[model samples]
Target: MTRKLHTLSTVTALFAGLATAHGLPATAEAAPTGQTVAAQDVSPSMLSAMQRDLGLSEEQIHRRLAFEATAARVELRLSQELGSTFGGAWLNEDGSQLIVGVTDEASAALVRLAGAEPRRVARSKAQLDRVMDELDRNAANASASSIHTWYVDLPTNSVVVTAADSVMSKFQAENFIARTSGAKDGTIRVVRSAEAPRPLYDTRGGDAYYPGNARCSIGFAVNGGFVTAGHCGGVGTTTSGHNRVAQGTVRGSSFPGNDYGWVQTNGSWASQPWVNNYAGGNDVVSGSSEAGIGASICRSGSTTGKRCGAIQAKNVTVNYSNGPVYGLTQTNVCAEGGDSGGSWLSGNQAQGVTSGGSGNCTSGGTTFFQPLNPILSVYGLSLTTNGGGGGGKGFVSRLNGKCIDVPNSNFSDGVQLQMWDCNGTNAQKFTWVGSTLQIGGKCVDVANASTANGTPIQLVSCNGNRAQDFVLSGAGDLVSYLANKCVDIKDVSSASGAKLHLWDCNGAANQKWDYR
Candidate 1:
C-alpha cells in the first residue's frame, strides 16, 4: 500500500512569515501542592475552537485547563495511593473538581487529602478490570453486531455494555452478559446505543496522507517520522506527503486488537513538535501528560479541522464492523469519515491518535483514540517535543527592542531581571525550552511562584514548575503559564534598567516580545 502526509512544511513557513513574531520559569519556588497551572501556549484559534464546541467562554477554557491539569495529578496520586481499593477517578461535569471512586472509607479519606471528592463504590478498579477482562476473553464467542461496544466506566464503577438499539440485538446482549462472569457478580450494566462504529476513511486536502486510495490524518511527529492509525496502512507500506512528495514507509502497525502505527520518514522530511491547528498554523506540542476523564479534549483532523469535547471514558472496547479494538479512550468529540489517525490533545498535552467512532461533527458523535504512550512504547519511538528542538533561543523583548537581561551577567538564583539595550550578549539571550524560558542555566521564574499581579520576575534554578513556564503566543505576548499573565516591562518602561514583572495580559507593547 501507499500513503501521503499533510504539509507540515507549510505550517512552518507560515509561522516563519508571521515571525517578523513574537514571543519563563524558575523556582523550587514550587507551586502549591496539587495546584493547577494556567494554560500554556494556548493559541487564539485553538481556544476559539474549544469555546465553540464545548460551549465555554475564553476565561472558562483557561480555568478548565488549570483544573483539569490539577485533576490529572490528583487522579494519578490517588490511583497509586489507593491501589486495589481505588475504584477509578474522573472530573466533574464542568471539570471544576475531580471525583474519585473509592471502595473503602480509608481510601476515601486518602482521596480527600489529595483534594479530590470521593464517591463510595462497591467494587475496586482491579475487580472491575477483571470483569472487563473476562468479557474481552469471551468476545470471540459473542455477537459483535449485537454488542456495539463495552467499557469500564470509572464514574459508575461498572462495566457498561453498550448494545445495539434493536430488540434482537438487546436479547443477544442480555444473553451475552448472562454468560459472562460479570453478570453473575452484578458488575455489568447494559445500555442501548445506535452506534455502528467504523474506521474513518479519507483525509483533508493538506492534512492527510493517502494510503493507496484510502486517506487518514497524520497523528503526531515522532523522532524519525509520524504515527497514525494502524488501519491506515500495513507495515512496509510506501507513502507520500500531502504535497505529493515522496515521504516514507510504515514501520509498525497494529490493528483489530489495537489501532496505531508509525511511519519511518526519509531524510527529506523532518518530524516537528507540532499539531495542525487547522487555522493555517500549528499548536505547540510541549509534552504528553495525559488528562483525566471528563476533561476537555480537542482533536485536529484534515476533514474536521478542530473539534472539542470531554473525555467520556477510557479502556474502551469498540466492536467495529471489522473487529474489536481494545484500550481505546472514548470522547464526546465528533469526528467523520477521513478523520482517522488525527491528533487528540487535552490542552497542550498530547493524548492519542484517532481510531474509529460513530457519528459526524454536524450532529454529535462518539470518538475514540489509540492512546499515544502505548504506541510509543510498542514501537520504541521517542516523541518530538518543543523542548527537544522546536523552540527558539535569543534576545526577547518588545518595546524599544530592549532585551530581557540578567544584571551583571550573574547566574545566581533569585536575581530579578531588567530591561537593557540589546548588546547581543549572553546575559540578554534566553532560550525557550518547552514551556520554560532560560537564561544562564536558570529559568525565568515568578518570585515565590506567585501568580498575583506585579509579582517580580527573577532568576531561579531550573525547575518544571508552572512558575517558570511561559509561552510566546502567536500574537506576540510573552505570557506566563502560572497565571496566564504577561511578562511585562514594569510600568511599560523602555529604559535599559526597567524592571520586569508579571501583570494582566493586555497585549501592550511591553507585554509582547520578538522571540519567535
Candidate 2:
C-alpha cells in the first residue's frame, strides 16, 4: 500500500498503448525472464518483485533501467548546457519517454534536438531555489505554518504549498506566503494535505542507531560513514549499532533548514556499499546519478526492509511543528516508525535519505527524504560502490534466526521440512535459482507437482516449471508459482513433526516464516 498516493497535478497524457496511468498505483511486479534477469545484471529477487508491483515486462524493465541510466548522463549534460534555465525532468507513465523542463525557448530547442521532449516552465529551477531560500529565512515565523510543505511542482509550474486543513487557517497561510520575498501571484499556490509531516525518528527496532536515545536507519554508506536524517542526531552525539556496540558519532548534522547528517564510523564497524533489501537480495550502490520525477524508485530501511514508489514532488519544503525543512523530496513510498534515515534509491543510484511523513505501512502512507546530492555536496563525501564489496549467499532462515530444515538431514525426495536451529548445514541452505527454492540443488516441490491445496510438500529435481517456482512475498508468505496458494503449516501445527503443506495464506502464524 502506497500512502499519499497523490500526483502534483495532471499533465499531458502519457504515450498511448500503456496500461492505464496513475500515481503510485498498488500493483505487483512481473516475473522477469531468465535472460532479462542476467542481461540487466540485477538481483532476480529485485526484478521479480518489481515485475509484481510495476506491471512491466522484462524488456520494459530493461529499458527503464537503460533509460534512467542514460537519463542521468543526459540530465547532467543538459544541466551544464542550460545552466540556470534548467527547470526539471521526469519520466513518462510507461517510462519509455522523458520530459525535460526548461525556462527559455532556446533551452527547450536544445532539449528537443537531444532526443527528449521539452516543456517551457514559468520559473527555472534556480528561481525555485531562490524562492525556497526565502521560505527558509521566514521559517521561524512560519513554524506554526500549514501542512508542513512548499515545493515547485515541475508540471504545475507553481510552488505548491501544503497545509493541514484542520490546523493552519487558509488566511494565515496566504499571508505568510505573500510576505515571503519571492512568493507572489501564480508564484505560490496552496494545497490541503491530510496530515502534518514530521521527522520519523525512533530507537525501538532493527538497524537501530541510538543518537540521543533515538533510533535511526542507515541512509547510505559514504567514505568514512553513512548519512541519515539530521533530526536523528547532532554534532558530537554518540551512537551505538543494533549489536549495542559503539559504532560512530555524529560528525555533522542539521535539521529544519536541512534534514541531512553524516556520522563518522569507529573502527568497530565496517560500512558496506550495498543496502540490505531483506526481500531476498542486496541492492548494490553503483552511483548517485539522479532519477527525475515520476521515475520509479525504491527504498530500504531496517523497519520495512524494502518498499518502492515514485517521486511525487521535489525542491519541496515541509513545515513541521518543530520547524520547517526545505529542499526535501516527497514520495508515495509507505514508511513507518524506525524507517527514518533509510535509503531512497532508483536502480543502483542513491537518491536521498528518509526524513519524515504521515501515515503507516499497514494503512498506506507518505514519506519525504533529504535528497543525497545536497548532503554529498555539503559534506564533500564520495559515495561508496558495490564494485569493492561482496554480498552474502542469499540464504535465510525462519523466525528466531534459525534454519528452515528437513529433519534427520534426509536427502530423499519425499521428506517434509521443519524449522529448527540452524547449524549452517547444507540442508538449511536455500538458493533462488530462477524462481525455484533449491536446497542442495533440489527444488522444493509440490506433491506430485499438483496445484491442489493441502498437498504435501517435498523436494524434487529441478524442472524449470511452475511447481518449482515460488515467490517470497513482503509479508513472508511463500506463495506458489502454480495456484497462488501459500506454503502453509499443516493443520496449523507449531510443534516439531508438524508437516508443511500448500494452503491458503490466511495471515496466521502457521503461514508466516521469518527469513534472515
Candidate 3:
C-alpha cells in the first residue's frame, strides 16, 4: 500500500483562477451558478477526498473553485470600498455562490454589483469586531468554564457565544454577555454546544517527530525550518525525526495566548514545500493566500493522514483545559491526538497549523487552527514554496551593519540596491530561494549580466538566470554566480544609502554579509 500526499501537478494552477477577476466594476455581476471560469487543475486523489468529505462531485468541485476565485477578489474589493458599512461575506454551504452582508442599502447595491449576493444586517463587521474585542478583554476574569467558544459569524453579522448545555453554563454565559459593554447592542448571540475543545497531542505516531516524549506533526516548511504547535516544545528544545535522527531545535515558541512555534533544523535535514497526502503523492504548497469561510479545506496529520472538511468560522477563541487560545479558525474537520501542528490547506493555499478541537473522526468533530499569516509575521519567516530554498526572512546585514534595502520597497526592474540602517521592515527583508536572493517576489540581479569591475546590482523579475543567482559563501562573502563576483558597497562607504555593486571576489570586510 502507498501513502497519499498533498501534492499537485503544477502549483500555478491552484491560484490561477484568482487572476481572472482581479478588479470589478460597480456594475459587475457574480459568475453564473454552476459555471466554471476555466478548466479545473485538481489531482484525482484530492478530488476524491473532497468528494467524500464535502459530498460534492468532481464537476461541483471545479465549479466551486472557479466561483470562489472570483468571490475572493470581490470580497477584498468590497471590504475596502465599503469599510464601515461592510458587515461580512461568506459562501453558501455548497460554495456555488457568495453572500455578503451590509448595514445599508447603498452597500448592498455595491455588493450586488461586485458579483456577490448582498443581505441587509443591523451591525457592521467593525461593530461586531469591537464587541468581540470587549468579550476577549473580559474573558480572562469571567467565570466561564462551560463556554465552548466565541467568534464572529459572518452570515449572522454578529458575535456568537457558544455555551455548554448545562443550565449553570447558560446562566454564566448570559451574565458574561450582559456584562459586556457592546453585548446589549444586539451584536451578541448565544448558542448551546456539548463539545469541549482541547489541544491534540500524543506520544505515538509515524510521520511525527519527538519534541520531548510527545509527538506532533509538521505544519509547513519555512526558509530554514518547519513550524508546529508551540505547545509541543519550548525555546531551545531539541527534536528528533520520526526515525529518531537528530532534526532541529525550537528557536521560537508561544502558547496559551497563541499556539505557534518554528524549529530551526540542522544541516542534516532539508525542508520541502510539500505535505503528505498519505494516499500516494505530495501536495506542493504554492502560496498562503487565506481562503474565505465556507471554503473546502483539508488537513494532513501523522495519525489520520489527510482529512477534508469546510471552514466554519474565523477569529474564534477556544477555551482549553490549560487556558484560552484566541484568534483560531474553526472547522468541521476531524483530528486526533498526535495530529497537533499538522498542516491545513484550502485548495493549494496554505491555511494554518492544527491547534486543537473537540470530538473524534469516527463520529464527526469540530477543529480549530492557528492562522499561518500571523505565525509568519511573528517570526519574520518566509514560506518555502515549490522549488524554493529555506533560510528564513530577515535583514541581510553587511560589515557596516547596515541592511540590504530595496529602496522604498519599490520592485521596479533595474532599481539599484542600497545599504541603509535596518529598521525591521519588508524593504530590508530578504530570503534565499535556491541560491537567489528574493525580496517582494523579485530577485536581486546583476545589472545587464555584466562582469565589469563595477557593474551595478539591481532588482528584477525572477527569471532563473545566472545574473540572479547568489550565495553566501562560507567565507562570509555574498558571491554572485554570474562571474563568481562579490557584491560590494561602492566607495567602501560605511554611511547609510551606500549603493551596492559587483566586484572581483577578495577577502575584504567590505564584501562580507550576514543574514540576521
Candidate 4:
C-alpha cells in the first residue's frame, strides 16, 4: 500500500469525513455524548501494530489514537461546512497535539467549534517556522563526532547509517539497527566517510555544472539536448564530457520546489534510448508508457550504478533541507549523491530521472526521480533510440490501432494526443509510417515540426512528408520527421481552447501524450 504523510493540521475536516464514513461521531459530539467513550475502545491489534512499527507502547498508542479519534470527529463537522476550502490536518511530530490549517478566521472558528484548538497562522509563516527550527537545530550542533549522516529511503520510510571507526559512530549505527529491528528491512556495511556533504554533482574529469552532469546516463536525447533533474545543473551552466570535453549548457533549472532541468547541447553529444550499461551487459531502454504504481523499476546511476526496485508512490511531496519538492515518484531503488540525473526504467521503457534518495546501496533506502514525460514536453526534444536499433514494429502498430478521436476542441492536429475509446472514425485513424503521423489520408504536419507549443498543426496533402510521420519517443512525446522535432501543445494545458502547436520537443508534461 502507498503511504503518504498527511498533515492532520491541514485536513482535520477531511479526516472527519473519513471518520464519519467509518461510523465515528462528528466533532460536535461531546465527551459526555459517548463519542470519546467509543474512541477509548480502539482495537488492540491497531495498538499493537503502532507499537511494533512506530515504537509506541500500548499506553502511548492508546493516548495518541484516542486523541486522533477526537480530532477526527471534530474535523468531520467542520469539513461539511468548509468543503474543499478546508486546508489540512496534521499532528505535531511528537504526536502529542494536533494542528489544523484553515482558509480564514471564519473557517478557524468553525474548526474551533468542532472542538479543535485552532490557531491563526499564515501558511508561509508556518513553513518558515519549521525551516528555522531545523536550521537552528543543525547550527547548534558543534560536533560531527557523534552525529553521523544517514540516508533515508522515502519509498520505505527507512534509514541507513554507515558505521564509522569511532566508537560513537558505531554506537549510532547499532542503535539504528536496534530501533529498526523486526521490520521489513535490509543492510550492508561500508567504510566510514566524512560528512563534507556538498550538493551531489555529476562529474566528468574536472569542470562542474550546477544542474547538468557528465557521468549520468541521458534520459533521452532530442535534436537540441536532453532532460534530467534540475538539481543536476542550473540555467546557463555549462556541461562537459567524461574527459572534460565541452558538451552542453543548462537551458533551464528548477529545484527546491520543482525537480526538473533541461540542457541544450552543441551536437557534440547525442542521446540514446539505452539506460545502464549494466557492467558491459546490454542496456535496457523503456517505452514511453508509464507503469502502474506496483510496477517494478530499475535505476542506473553513477554512484550506486544499477539496482532494481518497486515504485512505492507517485505525486509525493518531500520536504528536504533545501525546500519542499512536489510531484516526485518514490521508489525503493538505492542511490547516492553522484547518482542524481541517472535514469530509472521499467521493462525497457523510460520512467524518470534520478532526483535524490536517502540511502546508499549498502543498506536499503528509498529514492525519488523527476518523471521524464514532463521534462521532454517542456523542451521539445525527442529521445534517441537505444543502439540505433529502431523500436519494434509491433509496438508502433499497437499504438495506431488504439488511437481514439480527440475532438478538435480538445486537441488540434499538433496537440499531444491521448488515446480514448476507439469509435472507428477517420479522426482516430493515424498512420505512423516512420516518425510522422498521417491523419485523414493527409499529413498532420507541424508548421515547422518545431517543439514549441502554439505552432499550429495543419493538414497537407500527403507527399511522403517527414513532418507527418510521428514516433512516440521516450516519456510519451511524439517525435516527427528528420528534424527530430515533436508534436507539441501550444501551452501545457487541459482546457478546450488550448491550441495544438508544434515546437522543438523537450520532455515536458504538456507534450507527453498517453495511449490508453
Best by TM-score: 3
lDDT of 2 by residue, 1-516 (tens): 011111100011111101111111111123334322113355554566567667776666655765554444345445545677788777666665677888878777667655568888888877776776776667666645454677777777667777768544676677678877555546778888777787787722115677856677778776678888888888999988877788889999998778889988887777676777776557776556567787778877776667777788887778887777777888888888778888877776678898888887788888988888678667856566553322112223343344467778785777776666656555665543334566644678887878788897788766656676665554556767555567876776545556678987576767766543
lDDT of 4 by residue, 1-516 (tens): 011112233234334433443334333222233332222333333334335435655554444444454443343334334554454454444344445566467667656645455555343223322332332233223123433333322222223333346777667545434433311234322236443222345621011233333354455454466677776656898876555677888788888667777777776665554544445443534344454344445676666556666566565444455555656777767677777777766544567777776666787677777787566555544444432322211111132333334455233334444433445444554433222344443456756545454556666654545456454532455554333455555555444334456667576665666532
How does each model score on lDDT?
Answer: 0.75, 0.66, 0.75, 0.49
Ranking by TM-score: 3, 1, 2, 4
TM-score, candidate number 4: 0.41
TM-score of 2: 0.64
TM-score, per-candidate, Cα-based: 0.70, 0.64, 0.72, 0.41
**Model 4 worst lDDT window (10 residues):** 1-10
- Report the number of the highest-lDDT candidate: 1
Give the winner by lDDT: 1 or 2: 1
Candidate 2 wrong stretches, greater than 4 Å: 1-40, 83-85, 102-107, 166-168, 181-183, 203-206, 389-516
Stretches of candidate 4 exceeding 4 Å from the true structure:
1-200, 203-217, 386-516
lDDT of 4 at 431: 36
lDDT of 3 at 210: 83
Error of 4 at 327 (Å): 0.2
State the lDDT of candidate 3 residue by residue for 343-399, as single tens digits. Answer: 887766677899998888999889899998788767867787553454234545556
Worst 10 residues of 3 by lDDT: 1-10
Instruction: Compute the lDDT of residue 351 as modeled in candidate 3.
Output: 78
